[model samples]
Target chain A: MAVYTEIADEELERFLAGYELGALLSVKGIAEGVENSNYLIVTEAGPHILTLYEKRVDPTDLPFFIGLMEHLAARGLTCPQPVRNRAGEALGVLAGRPAAIVTFLEGMWIRRPRVEHCAQVGEALAQLHLAGEGFAIHRRNALSVDSWRPLFQRSEEGADTVLPELGAAILRELDHLEQNWPRDLPAGVIHADLFPDNVFFLKGHLSGLIDFYFACNDFLAYDVAIGLNAWCFEADGALNITKARALLAGYQRVRPLGADEIAALPLLARGSALRFLLTRLYDWLNVPPGALVAPKDPLEYWRKLRFHQSVDDAGAYGMDL
Target chain B: MAVYTEIADEELERFLAGYELGALLSVKGIAEGVENSNYLIVTEAGPHILTLYEKRVDPTDLPFFIGLMEHLAARGLTCPQPVRNRAGEALGVLAGRPAAIVTFLEGMWIRRPRVEHCAQVGEALAQLHLAGEGFAIHRRNALSVDSWRPLFQRSEEGADTVLPELGAAILRELDHLEQNWPRDLPAGVIHADLFPDNVFFLKGHLSGLIDFYFACNDFLAYDVAIGLNAWCFEADGALNITKARALLAGYQRVRPLGADEIAALPLLARGSALRFLLTRLYDWLNVPPGALVAPKDPLEYWRKLRFHQSVDDAGAYGMDL
Candidate 1:
């Protein structure tokens, strides 16, 4: 829960002057996003999200992120459409940070996502992948297989402090992934972080997907792998085959996977697991003193990686090639 | 920014089963309140705040706080009226914490409060005091003069760790206040923590007062003192006489101050300052390891206490006695 920057009434009034959004009724700092300051902005017209991109987000990459939302939104996807000002620009500056207002989507991200929720999310993910077909801009997946080594190196020295065998385990996984990672398959813009938190639902129906900051050009099937790792796991650290089958079946309903994509699922899943594990390990080892956000348990991803290592075929994930 | 407790969608749905509020639309965790987990709950009926009272709040005091809001709102004060569920209960349990749904008031708390804002706050405060005449629930001020010594003792040993002469300075101030603190004044249920953040304004008009957790029986003028300390201080720590005058004048317009209450303003302000200082000092010295909330600067209150010490007359605040 964070609102790192405070926007004053006078400043907000001045900032909204550029937009056709009517009189500001209220502005509340939402504590959802970790990478930016988000406010639920209500105007005389309607509710919108006013986001001030923080230092964690690269200003240059914002065009890709905002443009992706616009592109996908225009393509019949239910995402937050970036509200352009009267001057036809979607982005502006406020409180010394790059800011923009997007139409507020009405849905809650389900916690304890059931099998049906997983299926809805799967369908939404496929829809998002299809919607990105014609987007002009590109953003590279920064936390992909290639970047794991650097992140691992940064956290390696103190990795054992969290767990005795963490450093050695990471090294072994990194070596195995770098050599065996899938090289060729279907690729497009994927929501690299399609965790349950980023997917919203309205009464068992997929309302929309959000947080496009992590969307980038990557193997579209790799996104499916990420979703499998994210959504197919139970609270007890066991894989739920029914949910996995439902999610994959839901996705296939919209866009069927190719034979090569199906064959490469296990390897892609391992790579996806390793990518998250390295990043989490890095964050866990390097959490600054007095940080507002508690570093998530890196061991969770470590266990997920181990499970992926044990799986030798796509059929184990409740899918058949 | 706080949402210590995470409420699951299922848990929330079950909790709302008793409420007549239509199907839930969204619930966004609000990062505003310090002593609770607040979510901006949007349902088919309308917007409301779902607050889970945190550990800092004593569950026994829930009745007083909740009842005060109900009474005040019923008397035409525009505060958050507690929403009763189908069972006609304003408070229930959710996520293992005491929870309630309150009507969502529309307005923003001004960050840089102008004189007009201060005046509105003063008038609203007076209205609140007037409206509270018949409230049956009685809660004693927990941070009043008698409680300061115990709080000071808790932080006394390490007080000098924060500053060289701080420990001795606090003892001296406590000695002065204990000997001369007023025993006779207009006493009533006061909004004991009427900081600027607790007051809301809509388009420069005073909307309402909120956060009744700190409401308790105390000297009526002491609430004014708390407001003066909170609202009259400029960014540079200097007192703004214009704002103070506006606040006091606005209060006088609704409820005229007694001669004794006017005479006791300086001392009450000093006591108010010390009360906050001691609590902040204790918190600053004892912030638990890995605590989500950062301890506020105790020295800010020390500075306010010192400024109040320099004032020889109530006129120094702005209005003529």
Candidate 2:
């Protein structure tokens, strides 16, 4: 719901001259993506997403993000392929911000993702992990276990205000995780923020995955843990084991989980939960005055973290080692 | 940038059951139209806009607005044509709000409209007035002179806080307008809010007009006044006579202005300024806590009102009476 930079018509026309995208037909600011401004731009050729990287996105990390899309898409994974300009560059400047156009994926992200949708997401996640092999660039997952302490420190002062004793609860969880976090698992590029909104579907089939800004080098099995935390929880903070089994079965069918990865699922799930909980807590505590985007309830992740803490084995997720 | 209603996938599928639009391809909430939740929905047929009318819009006026678009489009005006469902209905309920699908127009609204764009807008506006002649459903202009006082009353208490002596100045202008408001003029369906954003352009030609929520029966020349105030003013609050001349000339070419309509342009412009001023003032003083949409500066309209008050004749607008 952000269009931080407004591209002037003349400037846009000039920018399009460097591309073979044909004449511009329409450009609309889309209410999607929070980190950058996105426009569903239609040219004489077809529809594409025009993204202007805002201050939130580090310009240095864009090559990794854009190139990953290209690499994955070339391997038959459905994702937004960055459109290179005639000058042979995938990125350019528009409206005084780094911008690029990517081919538009044709499907809507399902809201209330059913068991079937979860299975499809699981399969897609595995495919993405496989397709991401041998990427030239490397980016460390900035919001991983190591970043949680500093992130929590920023929000710890006011976390109790949101929920009674929430700060103490978070500190206890963070201490437990910092000491017990898994040190080794199968690692590769993982879409760290593959929420339901980032996965698009059409006719009950997963059409594509989007929002690669959070993709980075992390344990591939940790990606599955993130998906489990995101997709297996019902609105009332209860785990839906049937959907979790379906998602895990779907992923295993594509890329079988190793014994160690299966053994470490609970610990990885706790770390994933803590990652989101800290970030959400930070945002909740630091919402600037007059900010348009409402900070999400941080306690949702708190509930998920507590559930993961209660599970001592992967069997709780309806999966067998 | 508002998508107030989040339509569920199952609900959207059920809603699309009534349309011949083929299978749904994608639906993205678009950041357009302040009064409604608009989505750029693509089905097998093609792109269309799905608008869910919010509470700000009266449900009873749905027929008049939708009917006006259908009538105007059928009469050869380039606007969004309402798409009827299998039941031959253009409006239906979706997400518990009145909703409709309309053909998507291919053009972007110019950010900084030049003289040519102003002229094109003028000609298109004249054509709209002509095309709207035989529309059967008539709606009185809700924000007309008769409503200004009551509207101003809501904001009068804090209007001075926005600017020095602003409330007193508004009262004086309201008195003058009520005493000398034009009683007789060529009246018809006018696009009462024809700001640049409502007028789209493609390759430098006006492609279409949109946002018909404010359409109602009003003085045709009054619409022209709104266009002039909207399109012919510079960023620094000075009038651009060249653009104003071009807009008026273009309108004259399509349908000649009557002598009375020409004579009343200055006063109509003043009333138009006041209309926008009072509304903006109300919004400025009454912005709801945590509201996403920022209220536009009310004093911008105040400056325009002052300029209109200083003009004594139509010549100031570059039109000869």
Candidate 3:
């Protein structure tokens, strides 16, 4: 829920002059994205989303995000297609920030995601990974294993303030992940943050995946691991094996996991959980001023990490080896 | 920018079950309204605005607000028409808040409004007042003169902290307003808060007026005065008499202003300015916790009040009285 920058009507008209899309009918700031100022813009042509890239997003990495959308849309993936201006540029400046327009996708994310939703998301994630095969640009995953320790270090001092054993638990997990992090699993462009909110569904079907700011080249299997943690967990922090089996089955139907990938799933799942826990811990400790969102409890990820620690292999996730 | 309540997907589906709007497709929280959780919901039927009334709005006034929109829309005004469910109820409970769906009006509020925009708004407002003539429901303008003293008292102690002479000036103005306030005028339902953002324009024509939460029974001329202050003020706090004249002229074309109404415009304008100034002062002093919007500078209203103070008559607004 943020509109960090506001575009004046005159400025918006001037900006839209470069686009073939018809006159701007409306621009309603969407209380969705936290990393950017987003507006649900309507024009004579159709409804679209106008986003102003904020300081948090690296301008240099924008090309990768935009290009990935274009590539995915071109490959028949259901994602927002960047609407290029008449000058043929999809990205430009608005209100002193990099801005772009994308065609609006019509769907809502399910809060209480059923096992079927997990299965559908798994298929979509596999499809996204497959679709990225021919894309040229690459963005390194910034919150990957290598960055975890440094991120955890920032919150390490007062981490116990959140929970008595939180700091030591994170330190131990970081050490374990550092020593055992898989290096040779299959890699491709992964929507590093495929949270439920980013995945839209319509009429009980997955419509699209959005928010490509975190998309990057990472272990494709790690992406699967991330999805496992995100989609297969209930509110009580318990793993739903039925949803997990459905998710993995749906993924394997598109791109089967190799023996090494299967072997590495548990460790990668733990690493994914630890990665999120560290970042959530940091945000939980130091909420930025004027943050519109409440800090998600870091302990949520801590619980997930503990569950992953108990898992011996992918088979524990209801996968029959 | 506000989404005070988070609606679960399941709850939304169940709520929409009573509506004829077909299956729910998408729900995007709009960062526009300050007093409600508003979502641009789209279903098979089409796009509509779903408003979850926040605590700031009185539940008893829901009937008035919803009824006013329905009445205005039926009178051919291009505003959001409250959509009734199959049960014929326009308002219902969603996420423990009063919620309603209204037909989505397509138009954008001009940021830098021109004279033509002001003129169009003037005509539209006059039409709204006339259309609201037979409205059975009555909502007292809670921010009317009788309430200003109490509102000011809440912020009076810290008012001068915002400006050097702000506190004393407001008290002085309040005394003047309460003494000289017009006793008898053409009273009707007025869109008391006809600010620029509430009026929408498309292709340089006023398409609709919105946000009827502030609409109430008041001196019809006061509505004109509010619009004059809102739409005729330049960014530098200077009054644009040409715009003001166009606005008044536009209104006069629909329903001629009586001698008393014409004479009362200046004082009403001053009162309108003060009303907003006091509320803004209160909000400026105390922005709610986790507020998504920055408190607008109360001094802006103070400057407007000072400008209104200097005006001697309606002629100062370019009307040849």
Candidate 4:
């Protein structure tokens, strides 16, 4: 039996043959991943990325994804726009898997991200949130706190592996989080995965962003918290003041944060941390034996979730913003 | 096409037809996941979890999983053991996927864990490390420093989205990380995914551990660092003093740490923080469309990683072992 599968190049080529692009030069399967098979396609009209949906992706969601990206792009968000075929549909089958082409974003994602890089992400996130003001499509924040209890149910048997007291603590945290969760904040579309790789830059200037798969309507500050969690952390688990300040400052420049956003940051951060801890915890329980998929260390998010529980002040995360 | 596929009752029943345990009662696929399709299976053999390997699991590693559980079970680690079939193999094919039966543990993972609870986890972790030494199999820590580059590459495309300075900071951190990464320390198999859920308990005592997907050889202190990253954090992105002390004290009680391990902890913590930051950052870049996967808030990790970079002493991380 096949351990892993991928879409065929010829199949992908056949699917793209009907696209509007004048020429397709490169169709390279990027070997750098374990999820979807992605081909970097260079065309005479322009460069684009073709991704063959893998097992993790449900084929039915293809339209939603394509539509989401197109919607965000139309809203002035700098994300990949799905290309339509002669049928004016972005959804198509390639290699027996649902697939489509997305315009290749131009800037290289910095592997060696610096403190200031986080600030730029903060700015882009602010813009993304602002641009998401009236997006036609919507998706529930799938990893929200309301869903934690069910995730807990799946791993309930192994609760002792964490602690006999954990069940209560988790429930308590959830309750506390529920009571204290931020409300009355700027709500809008968010690039829920604003990791450095998803945001692009060129010659010291913001270029475009890609990968809006997790985009959803949520708290604006939660987006900032996600960026803070990703961009400002040091290797030893310390919060970099300079990086945090830079990110906040940059974000405020484009879209000044409101008081409620600041007030809600601590809880938002906790919620976000818990979200990761839960998912990583779930994945940790069930990673495949031989699959190269790297299992995320839930311990880190566990710590962050615990840390976020301690925060009461907005300043604890950064300068008030 | 089935948006959520069901494990056929006939197939599931036949799969368990002749088990010494008895007749099947019910099985329901649990969704809200990206990997395995888990069924809450109840049979004459008793209630057990039926996990259908989906996207991420490779079949070859099933034996290691099967073996590891058996080994842990022998060593008194409370965990689910893979049930062998009538043919005597622990693994089987089902629904076009690799499958297994694991006795469901009973309990709930704590979300808002207390300092005392963290202390318990710390002690349990040390015990796990001690028990890990006797396991027959050996696998090098795959998530060692070598893993960071691939993750960095994944996020390299959109590096400047957050900040241009972040790229330099990341390279500097990596360089500093390489220089300070611990090479000389106690090495043994680790329950690498030792989050709260993986641990099981009855009332107040630790009972069992479940997920061993990330088990491997690495600096024992690295495991401590993992714990520190998990249990010693505050909600506002700072370290929790009491929880930190409790956990470290508990760990030291069972397995006294070396001075070198103690001294190297600040760096170790930083490395641990970076490991998660890079992975989280990479995940941030790669969320699949239409999937329920939530992109973890990278900002919290960013905060933790930056903190690690700031620490110059193990004491900063509350290491006393």
lDDT of each: 0.89, 0.92, 0.90, 0.70
lDDT of 4: 0.70
- Which parts of model 3 have CA positions greater than 4 angstroms off? none
Q: Which runs of model 4 end up more than 4 angstroms from their true locations?
A: A1-321, B1-5, B30-35, B162-164
In model 2, what lDDT does residue B56 have? 87
Tens-digit lDDT track of model 1 for B91-209:
99999999999998888899999999989889998999999998998999998999999989999999999989999999999999999999989899999999978888888898878
Give Cα distance to truth, residue B39, candidate 3, Å: 1.3
- iRMS per model in Å: 1.4, 1.2, 1.7, 23.2
Model 4 chain B worst lDDT run, 10 consecutive residues: B25-34
Model 2: CA > 4 A from native: none
True-vs-predicted CA distance for residue A307, candidate 1, Å: 0.4
lDDT of 3 by residue, A1-321 (tens): 433576888899899999998788888988888689889988889889999999888999999999999999999899999999888999999999999999899899888899899999989999999999989998889999899989888998989898898888888888898999988878999998999999999989999999999999999999999999999999999999999999999999999999999999999999999988988888888877767666778889999999999999899999999
Tens digits of per-residue lDDT for model 4 on B1-321? Answer: 002334543466578874656765434343222346665555656557677776565666566667887877777767777787778877787877888888766543444567877888888888878777776777766677877766687787765575566666777888887776777788887776676656654444566677666677788888888888876788799988788788888988988888888888878777777777777676677765433344556657678888877877777756643
lDDT of 1 at A145: 85
Give each prediction's DockQ, rounded to 2 decimals: 0.76, 0.79, 0.66, 0.01
Each prediction's TM-score versus the true structure: 0.98, 0.98, 0.95, 0.49
Error of 1 at A310 (Å): 0.7
How accurately is candidate 3 docked according to DockQ? 0.66
**Which CAPRI level is candidate 4?**
incorrect
Worst 10 residues of 2 chain B by lDDT: B287-296
Candidate 4, residue B217: lDDT: 72
Order candidates by lDDT, high to low.
2, 3, 1, 4
| Model 2 per-residue lDDT tens digits across residues A1-321 | 433577889999999889998999999988778788899999998999999998878999999999999999999999999999998999999999999999999999988988998898889999999999999999999998888999899988998898999889888988888898888889999999999889999898999999999999999999999999899899999999999999999999899999999989999999999898888888888877656566788889989999999998999998975
